[model samples]
Target: MHDFCFAIPYGLILMTGGVLGYAKKGSTASLAGGLGTGFLLLLAGFLSLKAFKKGRNSYLAMILETGKPVFGYRGMVYAQSS
Candidate 1:
């Protein structure tokens, strides 16, 4: 539910761009681009949710939830605090 909630809006924006491109120039490439981008974002959101489920207190999730940079490493990844 959480992943879907985030993915839907992102997908809608991309889909709208694709529709606009098609309307403006009738290019199939524009339509494809929009669909591709939206799908990628949706996938990313779903993956993030899975990560959250596995590690509710994971460093990445903490930083993302707090909307702030956190220093130190979670495995090989490090975020520089600001």
Candidate 2:
């Protein structure tokens, strides 16, 4: 799936454009846009990292507690009853 494939590229472009605009034209809008976007990216990264750690910890806990593998598809949890 090409999901989220363009995120980084577009983010970089926005940042570069912002810097260029701020440097060449001295536009406050450009500076604000870059700062805002940078903040958003940072937030997204933080949230994603948190989510990944949470999921990994949960999976490991489940495996250790149940001694059975857990499975899921498309965010749907499937617990196998032993």
Best by TM-score: 1
lDDT of 1: 0.59
Rate residue 5 of model 1 by lDDT.
Answer: 62
Regions more than 4 Å wrong, model 2: 38-82
Report the lDDT tens digits of candidate 2 across residue range 1-71.
22123333544666787788899999997877675564444444444445455663233322322321122
Q: Write the per-residue lDDT of candidate 1 for residues 36-64, one digit (tens) a residue.
A: 66655655556567767786534443334
* lDDT (0 to 1) per candidate: 0.59, 0.49
